[model samples]
Target: MPQPSQDDLKEISRDYNRLWQFPNCIGAIDGKHCEIICPAHSGSTYYTYKNYFSVILQGAADANKIFIAIEVGGRGKQSDGGTFHYSVLNKLMESGRFNIPPPDMIPGTTCSLPYVFIGDEAYPMKTNLMRPFPERSLNDERRYFNERLSRARKCKCN
Candidate 1:
């Protein structure tokens, strides 16, 4: 087995960060579970959405929805927000570990564009991350946000 060098990690992060564009330019965040034999120490904490005692796997994807980095082995009961907090996502922001590019150069944009993650209901809302508003009908705010992302869209493989 071999380990990637620091440069390799930086390049990977940079690519994922630039994946698409603002609102559209976020990495995808999702969680899965890995089955494991019940551990005497934390069996109860390992129960998850699937009713299994397993370790959770968290991942970040590019605009293409291709996985860029992954973290696994946390207890399953952990919420997506909790999992992200303990994973590289946290360290990246705190230590400036991710290789995000400088702000976009498009004309007439006052907002400082941000690279973020697209999360689900299990995650928390914040500036660096976004989630679909859990409403029966998409209202004006959600509509505007969603419209911006889709308008700036990239292909699934892009």
Candidate 2:
């Protein structure tokens, strides 16, 4: 693995703390392109999107909306929604090290409580994976979560 630069590490640190700032919160996630020079052998692997040829990097961040960690170099064809199924990120969530926030499906916990992670429509909405309310209301909990997200960041909440 390549080492993160001092500047990169600093930025990551800022975002990581930000995401964790809220109770039961994890980082927000999405993928975008970073242009790469084409390598002849793996020609088609470099696909184009929004007029750029690059690989998509998926990531998660904390409530403060800071970038805590990222999964990079996945083929562009991959969906951000599917990234969580199997990855280092998923493993961390499954393990106890990353405390799950409130509203965890698990009943009865005796301690300070783990933080919860928020997800979006692209992700499978579930008790463990929280998707913000739909643009049009689907249910009370969805509506509540959506409203909460919107209030957090002007155009973006989750």
Candidate 3:
């Protein structure tokens, strides 16, 4: 699948805001383990925490639960963030060529915010990527943010 262009990203963010009431969310990113037979002469490189030989499929789903961008075939030992770090998408973002939107204020708030891709803890937090706070720490505001982000992802899935 082709990566989302700048205009496509804008449309995705709008769709997410309309359907999930989450502002500035262009997509939800995640990684899945796809089971596979270990390849020739490769030892445990494909071995995963799930107790299987696998490859990782890292992808970003738009508001309609459609994959707008996907990267596959990373070794299972790689972390989601690490796989992403080495991806073309990451390179584009790093090169300032991905065309992510400029920072703007969050809806109904005085706080300025940047458009971002939401992901689970396996992904790192950045100006354009968001992840839930560590579970060990609890605060009302942090918990609310995580819950709302999760609900937005769920809305897309359904």
Candidate 4:
């Protein structure tokens, strides 16, 4: 997939805000294990903890549940975080080539937050990536925050 431009990221954030009530969110990211036949001479390389041979398929989708980016061919034994860590998308993001916009104020608010992609705990937390609060001790505000974030992260494609 082609990389989205800065304007495209902004538009995706707007869509998340309008459709999912999640502000400053550019996309939702996740990974899936696609079962595959084991290759010759490959022992456990493709064997996953889920007891299957597969490859990881990582994807990021807009609020409309449209996939804008994908990374495939990761070893099935890897966790979502591991797969993402080695992905081209992560490299672009870390190298400042992803074209994400600078931090800006949310509408009707004075707080300046960086535009971010929402994901589950399997993904690392970064300035441009958001994960739910830990499930440990929870206050009302944190609980609500997790609820909203969970809703925004559910960008599964049909």
Using lDDT, rank the candidates from best to worst.
4, 3, 1, 2
Name every residue pair that clashes in candidate 1.
21-25
User: Which 10-residue window in model 2 sums to the lowest lDDT?
Assistant: 100-109
Error of 1 at 54 (Å): 1.3
- Residue 140 deviation, candidate 4, in Å? 2.0
Off by over 4 Å in 4: 155-158
lDDT of 3 by residue, 8-46 (tens): 888898888888888989899888899999999889999
The TM-score measured for candidate 2 stands at 0.58
Across residues 1-158, which tens digit of lDDT does each residue of candidate 2 receive?
Answer: 33334344344434433543233344455666667777668766666655556777777654445556788876654556655665566665667434443332212334443334456666665444556666766687767657665443222444
TM-scores for every predicted model: 0.67, 0.58, 0.91, 0.95
Once superposed on the true structure, which residue ranges of model 1 sit more than 4 Å away at CA?
Answer: 1-26, 105-111, 136-138, 144-158
Give the winner by TM-score.
4
By TM-score, how accurate is candidate 4?
0.95
| Candidate ranking (TM-score, best to worst) | 4, 3, 1, 2
Cα error of candidate 4 at position 61, Å: 0.2
RMSD of 4: 2.0
lDDT for model 3 comes to 0.85
Clashes of 4: 0
TM-score of 1: 0.67
